[model samples]
Target chain A: MNHVSDHDADHDSVYDGLLGGDDSQWAFGTDFEDPLAGVDTTLPEGVDGAALAAYCLMLGDDALVLSHRLSEWCSNAPDLEEDIALANVALDLLGQARLLLARAAAADPSVVPVLPEGSPVPREDALAFFRDQDAFRNVRLVEGDRGDFAVTTVRLLVASTWRLALMQRLVTSRDAVLAAIAAKAVKELAYHRDHAARWVVTLGRGTEESRRRTEAALATVWPLRWELDRTHEVERTLAADGVAVDPADVAAEVDVLLDQVLAAAGLEVPDVKRTGGLGGRTGRDGVHTEALGKVLAEMQSVARAHPAGRW
Target chain B: MSAVATVRTGYADPRAVAARVTDPEMPMLTLADLGVLRDVEVEGPGRVVVTITPTYSGCPAMATMRDDLVHALTDAGWSDVEVRVRLHPAWSTDWISDEGRQALREHGISPPGAAPHRDGPVPLNLMPTRRALTCPRCASPAVEVVSEFGPTACKASYRCTACLEPFEHVKEI
Candidate 1:
């Protein structure tokens, strides 16, 4: 059991009262009934709700799947300190995923993946733990195994860097909710990017083995990284309509930022090839690499097995 | 009970009521101290509108905060209440009031030392420990980070080497 303080003091502001303990359900890892309660849920004029829902899933799934992957390192990270750091990062992504999934549901209820009836899980949890592999919209990069510590760091650096760039642009979105979410989350994403960047730097320059592992990690992930930048047809259309930021638009910024981090870390940007093929389809099209199925199978197993159980 | 009748029967100003609604999670702080009591509007004689911003996108206390505001105002005899959440100009720890800082200290939690120079420059992060956080309990600079992620999203867990006590510090976001 963790020690939660009982101290409570009266502040000058009106929002003051004393809870006996850290009674916040979220602190104890419980979801609230509705995260979007009193906010106006109206879409901006001319923005398609269905399309907006689709757009939300694109971002949400990325965070959701990656969050799960990172959670795998909870007890398995190389060191105790790093175990907490990685889990914290995973929780941050999980938090974003929860919001994005909830937004998607609020935008269009049709987007909710079918969960077993009478399930007590929240809408966001349902989408996260119930959906099949092909239904997930995250990029192929985050779906793969947590290779080595070096691999995780480099992959995190690339993904978090790319996300920061997108989030920076997203703060100006036409959709007020989306813009608000981005604005609040950008700061978090900045920390995430910096955290990964520092690790990549340490690993790249520490010793011969670390340097080799970092380089190897970069090489392994760099080829598959191209898929993250390719925009889906829906995303492109939404970007044109001013509802979403196209994935392709952020590529330059991501590239420049990664290059700087890589150079500073004494690492090289590996010569990775694109896996894109006919129809320009990528993860955004409900298409993903072969690894995603195995990821989903493990992620969904517990929930699927015990559909009525509550965490 | 004597104060209740005088205050609740006809307290026209909704801010007074809304401000008193403590954050359910961090009980010592109020929405005003937290800098989230953005605006309170009196639509007509009895109608009121309140605006708030979340400290984080997935802040669970948001729903509780909204409900608390509505209930507190309604109990104060103000009908037709609307609580709206504003996301633009997102909430930051920097927005936390001085009174909020003092309150956090007294409640055994450390207020944010400084806002992370978020968009300042790329190297700000690479620089060693932007600012050292003092332990709220012992006011010692000898604290170490126990965990980057605390019990909740907006907090980081820290332990004081001086007092050997663990506490939560609001992380700059």
Candidate 2:
């Protein structure tokens, strides 16, 4: 891959070229090489490694699950460019999830879900592909269905907006790994927020059909958003210890950003009543919707088929 | 995350040879030219650690950059080479050197202008603004964005009205 032409970075074409050149670079699977290859991952004094692991799981799960949802649009987005956009966003989240999951697995291998006897997989893959829906710790905002383009755009706008706000503060975390991930992620999340915001405004102010659909999408997606803002006990504990961010604190800024986007899009913020929500079973508490189980069935199918497979 | 932070040995960094590695996607631009090269340092005459940041979180070129750095250093006879990626003071398009920006324009990619400060309260690109992008092909401010993303993740697709040529616009992060 040289600076030969415009084709070097084409997502699919890279695989096409690599397929012909190097057997080592099969171009089929992720580069599972350790992301924190040479960095010091030691926890600060008195900061519980287990607690930090849990916090990392909470953050990692959000990114992993949302990345899966976003990737669902790969070939189905309204246009070619949009398909690329969604995939780029998904890959960014996947990259973040990869690093954080590796961190979690490093801090507490005990939390890694069990797999078959002789099956070997990276910790991040094990966490993403082996866990049951009940074992996931991502918030509900990222676990549900990826709706129509309008709904997805609105959801992306909301999800990235909230994440950006949270990441801004996380960049200053006491944990170096968490801080680095946050520092890296906030930039990517900022683009996701803005990209979605553009579509949101375009749809919100487009033809009558577009306006109606955008409003309907907002109605469906806005209620689940509250689940993301509520602080889970694990996050709350880590927040107190300066190891994690409290979701509650990010809400005010998130609200302000959401309002700004909504206003610019000429859409009213929905007053959708929060459903049973994260009540007895919040996502951080390992509670997720049935949709997640179905999603995992599909996402993990290939790995489950050949447990020891290395692509 | 590896429990042990092992720095690979048998590498060299004479003249900062790795800094000359070009971005794999945009071959015309070196990583140093793009401001992706943050620092190159030698430790005790035995170790050379090169710190580089990715232009985007998902930029595919990062892996290529790292591998290129290691290979280049190994060829230069350094005993130990360490490449550390520091995410703090995150990489921004604003960091592109003046020379790099000039290189981008000369190579047919419009260099990004100043973006909203990360320190600013508002997140970037949320508001709709249709600033006429200056065209690299014709040096005209009459270019219109055709797509938010381009052939590469770091750029966007646009066409210049003056030259009527489609080109890449380096997105302001």
Candidate 3:
């Protein structure tokens, strides 16, 4: 009477190799190790670590949401190469999101409370499991809907332009993590901006229908542009410390670049009124649209499902 | 394993190593083949610095390529490797070598045509009408674009009626 043990079973052994075996020999480790270890954790003198973390979350959330929106067009893009291009851009933003979120979690003292023995939660776990949307600090442009190609391109141009400006300044940030992330992102955003700019010109100056549709998309998105320039005391504080972009400075440069792009396409800048009445302080105050909540659910769902599952 | 003992160590020249480092996205061409690997310098005893310029400002692979450079160099036994990214001269399709073009054609990607007349009266962006792309498979000047983009960002998808084959063409920058 031979008894088959579960551990000794051949079929179960094969399944274990496929599913649970230690396969860390891959090119990059697939095991769920934190990608942010060894990152410089010191904040600039006179800077509030918690505030900086909040600020970084805003930036990270913006990239993450926008990347998610762009990725939905993976196979649905006009062409195969364009599909690859969009996916590449989305991957770039996703990389930025990962680094920025890691930094935010590392900096925020409030997010990582003292354990039983007064030790703090690991930064990786904090970013992976903790934090909600109200804790997110991303901008309206990135969180906005993915409309037509024209709308997508317009938003890309606007977001990339402003991001480039901010990243240019960020290279000199007092925070090493911010500077490192910015240094890598500036180059990525430059290409993103160029890609969007080319599309905008092509669509805006193309046939009558294309031009009209692009103009309408621009008009629809123009009102949300004001939210990008909404300044806060935290931003001012960080800007003074040379750790964050002065939202006001980015606004002026963005306006000029946008104007030049519109002029080139022989299109007028839309006159849509800013949503100033609704208050532009929503993101900084931990307030967001229904879209963000939906996005967060999708993003965190997988990680939450199998809390400690390793691949 | 004794072949490893004969291998030269300590900061193998970047120019030599870079000759082998092809663009991951454009596998048909190497960094040296693309002329994007601008310079290689040996600093101090064991430190090697390789400089590269991106074809475009916001190319996502720039970071990955930098990491690749470091990994490749370090794996080859170079103790200290540094990759410096430069953007001054900005990459152009013109930088792509004839060898690279041949490789691209062999890989079913059409190399860019000669630069159109943009210096004269015509504006740079509006000047060139799309020219008939030659079938890389058959060399017949009868290919048509299936799509503006291909499997990757740098290439476009094209199909040749003559050969009845679909191919990826490296787009003109």
Q: Best-fitting candidate, measured by TM-score?
A: 2
What i-RMS does each candidate reach, in Å? 4.1, 3.1, 7.6
Candidate 1 segments whose C-alpha is farther than 4 A from its true place? A1-32, A114-122, A276-280, A302-311, B1-18, B21-25, B37-52, B59-85, B114-124, B132-151, B156-168
lDDT of 1 at A211: 96
For residues A1-311, could you state the per-residue lDDT of candidate 2 as single tens digits?
36555454455354566445443243222434456676678887678888888889888888888889999999999998899889888888888888898889888788887776766677778888887788788887787889889888888888889888888899879888789888878767877888998899899889999999999998988878888888877788889988888999989998888888789889999978875645567777887788888789999999877767543
Q: Per-candidate DockQ versus the true complex?
A: 0.28, 0.36, 0.11
Q: Which pairs in model 1 have colliding backbones?
A: A14-B19, A14-B20, A15-B19, A15-B30, A15-B31
The CA lDDT at B8 in model 1 is 47
**Error of model 1, residue B166, in angstroms:** 7.2
Docking class of 1: acceptable
True contacts kept of each: 0.39, 0.34, 0.09
Q: What tens digits encode model 3's per-residue C-alpha lDDT throughout B1-173?
A: 35333443434665677678878678678888977888887765556788876664335555556666666777666777776655334456777999999998888778977543222211213222366688988988887876554565555668888989988776655
- Which segments of candidate 3 are over 4 A away from where they belong? A1-22, A37-39, A109-130, A276-280, B1-173
Q: What is the C-alpha lDDT profile of model 3 across A45-151, one tens digit per residue?
A: 88888878877877877787888888878898877667777887887787677777778877875664233343243453456345577766777667766888888
Q: Write candidate 2's Cα lDDT for B1-173 as tens digits.
A: 33222332334344458768878888887788888888888764456788887677667677777777766776687657777876666788888888888888899988887865647545456554465568887788887887777777787778898989999888877
DockQ of 1: 0.28
Question: In terms of docking quality, how is candidate 2 classified?
Answer: acceptable
In the range B29-53, model 1's lDDT, one tens digit per residue, is 9999998889998766567898887
Docking class of 3: incorrect
